[model samples]
Target chain A: MNRPKEIFMMTFPLILLLGVLSCLYLESCSAKKEIQLIDSEPYPIEIPKGFPDIKIPEGNELTKARVALGKKLFFDPILSVDSSLSCGSCHLQKNAFTDLRTTSIGVEGRVGPRNTPSLVNVAFNPYFFFEGGSPSLEAQSLGPIETFHEMDFNAALLTKRLAADEHYQKMAQEAYGMEMKLFVIVSALASFERTLISANSPYDRAINGDSSAMTPAQWRGKELFFSDHTNCASCHPAPLFTNFSIENIGLEKEYQDKGRYRVTLKNEDIGKFKTPGLRNIGLTAPYMHDGSLESLDMVIEHFNVGGLGHKNQHPLIRPLDLSDHQKKDLIAFLHALTDQDVLLKPEWAP
Target chain B: MKTIKVILMALIGLTMLTLQGCDNSGCTDPDSLNFDPEATEDNGKCDFPNLTVNFSYSVDGQELTKGTTYTINGTAISFSDVQFYVFNPRVAKDGVMEATGETHFISFDNRSIEFEDLTAGHKHMLMFGLGVDSTTNATIQPSDSDLADGAALGPQNPSMHWGWDNGYIFLKMDGMVDTDGDNVPNAGMEFHIGKNINFNTIALEIHTDALEDEVEVTVDVDFAKAFTGIDLSKDYITHTGDFPALANTVINNMKTAFAKK
Candidate 1:
């Protein structure tokens, strides 16, 4: 063969091989990497009548996959530092998502400072915690995960741990279209929590044209609750049963725990706390911010006698001098607030 | 064998000629550790040298540590934990401020702060906030992409970030004081100072020196100054908002505490 043909013979196979390899690499680069979702059904939240529309963050829309992922993580101990506690440990479904303990118990028996609030109707809350510190549910989820007495786990480490599991990776991808990241973890959890709407109570039913739903005693208690004598409706109004105002209800004479003051640092906010929704108040026993009041009876008595009259106490919180029978009626009315369906809802459970 | 050698030589020549036509891809920043002066192209992987700042706490000329006892104003006191947040570091040359927008969480354990992006310069003034800046303090959730794991704004163990308030505790000095004359710290004393109003800017004029590419500076923090004019025995607790006067005093004292060593 001629010299040119000999060179061509030597380099043709090499050139073809290089071309094939380059095409393969280019194909890999140009191909759109589609994430295989486990399930991505859009979850439309069923807002009850009289309940305000939940404002979900634009980035985090409700999805079945996202809520499912959050529900799984909420009940899983993998987020804890010791892998011994989960959000479910403190917020049980039977207790309207409250732990029933005076204060919450964390991983390794570490005691939390505040009582576990019910997750029901939490999506309606403008801010989180009794102090109203956190601005959003996404931000509030970080509190339990990082608090020393709670999960005591680092988000970086938790993500790293979750990333190791293929199942978690797939779930995270399905939920967030991303790996198991800090944002995904918090956002997913918030999505699930926002879906925990508890509006199907006896009071809710009675107000919605079902007059037989509420008993006569509960109806009487409702009248007193809305009446000017108690002024309960001032802070805790109807429908949601909470005005969502931060107030000093005169829980103590000298406040041991500075409630809203911790958030705002205002002198007037020193002994103030967010007025929690009365919905599910019956199942969420051991009431008050610190769970100081053990039952609905104790809560009514505290309110009836008027709070200890702290310097910054709300003027509306005064001695009602409610009769024992009136107190019982109020307690019975509170029991009517419990939504039996939400308590046993399989979607909320582990 | 001769034909194979000829082909290998041709391939080697082709490789060298091809390399001459292409630009070398590498980090071109002079301040970076892997800076390539000859590179004509940047691959965007620049490994900048860390500018380290070592903060050593002292109380009355003695090295301060957890459980380190000191007598102040005829009262004995000892600390269990002391932590603070440092952010918005800047090195100035003749009045021009060079800002390194970074925040750091400082405790007794992690006192050596490393700034990866601070460029080398002959800086006469070193300024940093004793607490997080208002913009960062306003960030309730520190999981933002910019706020990394060790960032002062991010979550920490023995958390400086208040989950309740959604703000960082600028300076936390938790300890106990001897109230009953036993010469032992028995009563709890805590100064959890934090808030947007309490963020203090600490500016120090150091001797004119050329800060090397990878410089290390030692700063002495006299924590004893943090308790000046305060009765440690009685005024033991201040969570900034709860006790604004005490918090302001501590913050003002801390502003004067840091000095270049």
Candidate 2:
């Protein structure tokens, strides 16, 4: 007994059940793969070469049943009020889950304030939306549908709408047991979005010691990008190609639409927006929060001049004064970030 | 032979220990809805109930019984519509919860709202939020369980949701009230309150009766009480995000607006 007491100092702490711990515990218990809603195996979320472990939220665990249900819901237009659009209508797989439109159109031909965001590698994001308001994929899922310009659907009616469908009813019973609820619907959708992994790009391979994966011009551009003078890598970090921190980047002298400030309500965060990952960046355009820039050339030119130098702009953002040839090299590197295989994934497409 | 016999005995001991740990397992989480006391291990079988509490729109503790006008402060206030959202109910002792309640939407037309299921041995004191909390307001989704009931043969409509802000309007009181002590009702009292900042909480003690499953605990909202010390002859129309500060007087008066009957 005396020995046990003495050794207590050297021993590990006892496991305590805590509310804070629950929020960080992302994955569900990986039980033996037992089929429920579908005849499918548990989809293992693939961790890319350099990315950290993906933590699915505590309440939501990615199971085969949930993902299958989510896939059906993602493609279904029934989530919309008028049934004129679906999530797939704007977030097309070919464009790497972005509406190629300058800004997405809404119900009754209304134009929205912001651009339709790309969902590629969205699971890896620390926060959701252009302003980085929602912390989880599940939390961000409800935003567009409630927006008058988007699907314009009330969340309360989802249970009735989903319950009416025989396919959804059977699936709901098999996956969650009992009838359809709002929690089940969003959890399923968030799980399906988690399955969208885009790690097969040539740049990813090149970074992982495959010198032949990328062209020589792209290689030269990579040097300038990571170099201190260019100052791209400081914000657009490696692996996911985004540090996931909010920045102003001097988009305007004064913002017509305040970005991160809308969420945070702080003056310093006024024009700040999330640093979007560079993966599949080429496919998803026009760029920026308003989608004001049309092409890679325009984005490069903006950076070359180091933006308009707004007050809160990052210290690293300054005029590179790059020559025409160097700008082309950088644009070529961005194009190499594209992964063609993501577009061909049948399960992701409608 | 001796070595093998000793090994078999050790294996058997380990098996018995494992079996003993697994026996009569149940939900051990204190926060879980189906918490069991005699459980040796947790089996993750936690299920919370949908406890539906109710409300009765009244005038000075007297039931108006629909379209009934009541005279107070020398004005005739007739309410055409009266509704609000309540969230995160809890049974408390001195302010600590004995059980948790679900978020609900209630109105005069449909006064009943089912909350989360209770386990056992909870008392009369209750606590609930007048509107959606900051976290819920920011992260609301369509399939959110907090919604009272998705409207199907029910009056819990989604129109109460603020389509622009992505949050539900916490309270809406639309009626005509005579502000100048005139016999005729003239002023349109459109006081719809929402947004996370304006959300308030109420800690109530149900002194009238003991708590039971599905028992009605009436919370009163008096239009007369809102006009106790102020004139409502002004425009009084509060929008979703604009002028929440202007509606503070009406919102603060709601602290005394609810009482156990």
C-alpha displacement of A263 in model 2, angstroms? 2.2
lDDT of 2 by residue, A1-350 (tens): 79887676545343334444664553232221222334334667777877777778765677787888888888888888888878888899988998898999877888987877778788888778877766667766767776668888866676678888888977766566546776777778888999998898889888788989999999988888888879788988887889999999888999977787655556788788889888888898899989989999999998988889888888777899999989999988888899998889988989
Per-model TM-score of chain B: 0.77, 0.67
Worst 10 residues of 1 chain B by lDDT: B140-149
After superposing candidate 1, which stretches have Cα over 4 Å from the reference? A1-32, A35-40, B1-54, B62-83, B107-124, B145-152, B173-191, B211-216, B229-247
Cα lDDT of model 1 by residue, A234-338, tens digit? 999978889889999888888878898877778888888999999989888788898898988888888898888899989988899999989888888988898
- Predicted structure 1, TM vs. truth: 0.80
Compute the DockQ of candidate 1: 0.32
- Per model, the share of native interface contacts recovered reads 0.48, 0.24
Record all residue pairs in model 1 with backbone atoms less than 3 Å apart, i.e. clashing.
none
Clashing pairs in 2: A155-B142, A182-B143, B49-B116, B49-B117, B50-B115, B51-B114, B51-B115, B52-B113, B52-B114, B52-B115
Q: Show model 2 residue runs off by greater than 4 Å.
A: A1-40, B1-83, B87-104, B112-129, B132-156, B159-169, B172-197, B201-261
lDDT of each: 0.83, 0.73
DockQ for all models, in order?
Answer: 0.32, 0.14
Best by DockQ: 1
